[model samples]
Target: MDRQFYIISYDIGDPKRLQRVHKFLKDYGKPVQKSVFECWLTERELESVVSWLADFIKRTEDRVRIYRLCRNCLQNVEFTGPVYFAEEPPEELIL
Candidate 1:
């Protein structure tokens, strides 16, 4: 399956919900910041993430944004200070 890079960021009004969202995202991506994540996901995974967030957040209280990064965009991403971008995950890992 082909996967694309996504930058997911969120703001939650409550601490509990914020923690919940952070924990859930950890399963699917790497945290680039306190409330920002870098994920490489297929279409199915993206849909699942969106669906889960849709059901979990309060529309009036929380905000979530997912930005799809194309190959060119990913290549041109810049960073400064101590922060770095997430690397692409390897396909088919055997343990």
Candidate 2:
């Protein structure tokens, strides 16, 4: 699938909230690293997911973000897929 991936970072105010968001992201993808989570969606779906996340955060007192994959795509950095979160083959995977 030819789609963009996102590395969302939420500056959640509290550890419990941080954990809450992390758990929520599990519905989307896995955590390839700490704080940073990976989730793949097309141009349109991405916006929906971001909006959902923002609204979710608004229900609480925390910070959220949806940094564009295009902006964060560096030359040499590998972090994608649901390796730590999926059993079947995920459409998006990076190593």
* Superposed model 2: Cα runs more than 4 Å off: 58-61, 71-75, 78-95
Candidate 2, poorest ten consecutive residues by summed lDDT: 81-90
* TM-score attained by model 2: 0.59
Error of 2 at 32 (Å): 2.1
RMSD of each: 1.9, 6.9
- Which digits, one per residue and each the tens of the lDDT, describe model 2 over residues 11-33? 77778867888888877665767
lDDT of 1 by residue, 1-95 (tens): 68899999999999999999999999989998999999999899999999999999999999999999998987787778785667778886668
Model 2 residue-pair collision total: 0
Question: lDDT per model, in order?
Answer: 0.93, 0.65
Which pairs clash in the backbone of model 1? none
TM-score of 1: 0.92
- What TM-score would each prediction reach against the true structure? 0.92, 0.59
Model 1, residue 58: displacement in angstroms? 0.3
